[model samples]
Target: MLSFTPYENPTYFGILAIALLPIVIGLLCKKRFHWYETIISIFFLVLTFGGPKLTQGYALIAYLIYEVVLVWLYTSYRKHKNQTSIFVGAVILAIIPLVIVKLTPAIQNGQQSLIGFLGISYLTFKAVQTIMESRDGVLKAFNPWFFLQFLVFFPTISSGPIDRYRRFKKDYDHVPDTDKYLQLLQKGVHNIFMGFVYKYMLAYLFGTLLLPKLQQQALSAHGLSWSLVGVMYVYSMYLFFDFAGYSLFAVGTSYFMGIETPINFNAPFKSHNIKEFWNRWHMTLSFWFRDYIYMRLVFFFMKHKVFKSPKTTANITYIINMTIMGFWHGVTWYYVTYGILHGIALVVNDWWLRYKKKHQKQIPHNKFTEIFAVFVTFNFVCFTFLLFSGFLNTMLLAK
Candidate 1:
């Protein structure tokens, strides 16, 4: 019995390749061996959570059972009755495990919760959204088995491009045409190879090789210095590559199974503003927040006259939504600050956009401005990543 993190090393990918071969072949031949797919998925789950990580395995199992049944019950109830209180209760219950997991570390001086396991947050996201959609009458026909598959879709299970229930079901229920399947295969191979460069090569170069040195240098500086700047830039690169690389692997693996999982990142560093950065980076998660949280909050605010102006409503929701996202990352002060700053950036960016649009005749819209915008956004993001990294906390402690 052995345990491994998803996409952690060469050996895991090797096993993955062997396992995916059957799926690739089946898709090529216009066949889907779902039974086989389930078996391999379970096998990979074991490799990830079994052996020394068996406690996590148990937690995952119990968590899945609770969520699946909870969704089932909600779907059952939603079919006939739609009570807002019930829906809210269900959503809260779905997130309770994740909340406890997050709070345990902060409350208990960094002791991990017994019920916590890798990807709990992601799983909770899936479950809560399912409930939300169910309440909205969007996800009418809820298949418990398929829902379970989507939640445990081992490829994007741990960290996600956060596929929706309806979207996933559409892909799962259909077989792509020959040409499309071939294209998917080609892209899948390309994505996996690209992931190797991102996660293994460049991330290693930045995070493993460069980040530690920069971190040590920055820490010893006892104050802001060039070393801190180096740490900021190197860490920003490392964070992007590490996550973008994982996203590539998850999406590429999904492609092999003919599932067409949504991508998580674009050229995020090229974004000209914080809003655009979010749209380009972690596309799925941000979109989820937009659809499920921000949009809903805005609608509620507007509906109930919570704010006099629609713009004000949006600005307030942006802060609330992103702050929750930050807390979702962790309970630490740095994480919360990271979210709050992004929220403020979004508000400011929106204001600037509105002002620029009104003064379009006076405002110079040119190539240079675009480039300058990119520079500003990238550097601002890097500085925020410095906060997100918790190195500033270390600096404060050193002081």
Candidate 2:
């Protein structure tokens, strides 16, 4: 049976509270590793790894090994001033673990329980992106400790906004006034409550009440799979509230620590287009893709003989970017479908925009169009979420 056991588990909640204590204390002490803003992130990583039961030890061990190697490589690159080569190397290195995990299904399905809860993907990307930015001279270099802190920040570690180094650095560099800290605490507490409400109240409520019926209907082939569609909508909304709410808590918690981590969502459901939806949804991860993947793809394609002009071959770039976005979610066919669906949507949106621009006098500029666009865009996104949440197969095979 489908279950919401994780959310209801008191032991897990207790562990989370305990894990956050050290981070709170560290913040109170104005903890700065190596007197560098970048180094302070290590403390939070430790706390994050300590949250889960079975995987805590393994996470800590992996984190330690990662910290040692990352520090060594970063320091050597900095000392030799080989910034360009080192940056390229960091981006490549970040992919190693992700590649290994994805290619080796055995690792994911292995008996080792620790491997299952390994939320390494989120941390690894954050680390790699920070290092890449540092190498590009876009962000300042900080010692390993600061990097670790950002990587392991407890609230967002399990799921994340995938914050970049430059923004993180800005937060850590500023000393907060007492009033600011108090305000942060107020917001943090409020956000935590709202997170619970969004998570447990709406998302969880709909999920528990409706999702199992879809699963059953899908199994029994008893109906038209309308239940599955309902579940998809619920799942989509559930995911946002649960994830975005958590990110809000992370932002608020970091704020209290005198670190102004960026917000992750901005009314993403209201987006009229796929591109706009991405901008509002998981804002940090989208930016990460823009900076690390999309930009690189654009440059690479532009350099190739087949794609000389981005203006003429914009569709190619759009397809490549969205496909990469799909792959980033996981090594699954469903994820690929989700990506392709969005890619096509983006292309259509772009064409429509151009058409409207070319015929501005004839295009409708009414609120109705805007409202209709929002409704269509939302349902489109919800349809894709079926693939995202792995309900597509469940719906298809249901009796």
- Best by TM-score, which number? 1
Alpha-carbon lDDT, every model: 0.94, 0.67
Cα lDDT tens digits for candidate 1, 208-283: 9999998888888899899999999999999999999999999999999999999999999999999999999999
Query: Candidate 2, which ten residues in sequence have the lowest lDDT sum?
Result: 1-10
| lDDT score of residue 260 within candidate 2 | 66
Q: Model 1 lDDT vs. the true structure?
A: 0.94
lDDT tens per residue, model 2, 233-279: 88887788877766776666565556667778999999987889988
The residue pairs found clashing in candidate 1 are none
**lDDT for position 391 in model 2:** 70
TM-score of each: 0.99, 0.83
For model 1, what is the error of residue 154's alpha carbon versus the real structure, in angstroms, after optimal superposition? 0.6
